[model samples]
Target: MTSPAPAPETVAHDDLCPICHLLLYAPVRTECNHLLCASCMAQWADASTLTRITPSSLDMDLSAFDPNYDPTPDLEAGCPMCRTLTAAVPDRKLAGFLEARYPAAYAERRVEEETARGSRVGEDGVQGMMILIGNRHRAERGGDEGPNKHNWTFFVRVSRPDIVKEIRVNLHPTFRPPRVVLTEPPFEVRCLGWGTFTIEAELVLNEPYGWVKDGMGSRSQSLELSWMLDFEGRGKQGRVRAKVKKLDGDADHPIDVDARASPVNLPHMDHQHV
Candidate 1:
């Protein structure tokens, strides 16, 4: 018989037995998937224990390690993938190997970990009364479709019908010298208006900025008014809302105010109005 195709070379776990080599064991694996005896491995793993490999160093070893206990430490319990006994373990480095080798498993672990912590909700809903504004625009009032040269005045009125005190108005930065006028209690009101004109608050006869912009631009200015209702009560809360009313008849109609842009006639004859 042809010399049996050289019997596949085989390695053993105890090939370099620490007992015979007189060195600490460094566990290694075999081709047949058997663990090797490492001389250095045993020494490092059990360095703190009272285990003596060499008789001459017995005194020091006895003091450090437990003499009665035989420490048999395995680098790893078993193969992570196959769950079978392996000759060697990568130890802490095993995480990287497993993640690269098994992406699906790694992802599953991450998801499981996150789920165990808690669920996340993006935002909270308002339980008490709160006001939100939007859709503000501006343009010359009444005169013509094109840009006007008249100044406009827009009035915003807020009615707080609650036992509230100290209301704050978060006016948009663009509101020229935003002024807060307090009128009445159990209902605080403020008036703010501005525009470009020479006389009293008047609307421009034509679009002022329309020359550079088509149908888009600052057709109206925006103002954001927030109210900080400081009222004391168990269930009493205040609500705020704004309505833009034309203060000057120069504009065809008063611009309904929102948290967006609104058109107001520019002031005219500043010297006389001031």
Candidate 2:
């Protein structure tokens, strides 16, 4: 019997937005089928004026009465490339393709935008830290099978190495009471397991800081993190960061956070059944 031919591969084109000259973000398609970034088109529409007005009379009082006086500027929108009047619509397929093909670029852009917005710090005087979790082994495999298989070693990391004193990682009932501890920077741990768990970290602060009531320290501030290991859109690994804040009554909460994974490394996989 002859073997069936391999399925044809889909190739992505190196298409760049004319305005940004880079991979499109939130791409939109004009009626002419040309693609452009949504933000870029919006900006062009605001800047480009369809009509220009000149007052016939120089007198300020009679300017309003002048026949040639047109107060409003025409802001009709058109394609920046072809100058064709068309309505831009969201191109979901192209958006998905850009995200999947350029995962690193998208992640970097997200980080840059977040940083520009000053989201790395909390208003409550708490600092921000990054938590990187993933399996290097699975990443190295570079195959479809490893991503789908659940048996892999996972790791966790803290970005602010200088402030962290100790890290305690605890897996649910599988690995209990004896929490894994690390006393240094790169507070990362590796283990072979699946599911979610709690992480607690002790911080080396400049002075005693926490919820103090009636001249007594009620609760010490700690960075508590929880994450789950599941192969969904996050292929082999992913990274997340949050701002740690000390709340009233000694409660700690992380906020103003972000998480991202590479679509290239973790492409959507199809399941096979026997």
Scored by Cα lDDT, where does model 2 land?
Answer: 0.43
TM-scores of all predicted structures: 0.17, 0.30
Model 1 off-target regions past 4 Å? Answer: 1-127, 132-139, 142-160, 170-177, 181-274
By how many angstroms RMSD does model 1 differ from the true structure?
32.2
> Mind giving the per-residue lDDT tens digits that candidate 1 earns over 1-274?
6665544323233332333342112333433354333323322222121111111211122225343222233322333234453224313243444456445544554454336421111011000111221112133344665433223222222221131212223333454433332222222222223333111111111111110111111122122343222112211122221111112332432323224222322221111112
> In terms of TM-score, which candidate is strongest?
2
Ten residues in sequence with the least summed lDDT for candidate 2: 265-274
lDDT of each: 0.26, 0.43
**Model 2 CA deviation exceeding 4 Å by range:** 1-126, 134-151, 176-178, 193-220, 231-241, 244-274
Candidate 2 lDDT over residue span 192-269, tens digit each: 444433433223322233211111222333444444444443334444433332443434322221122212211111
Per-residue error (Å), model 1, residue 263: 26
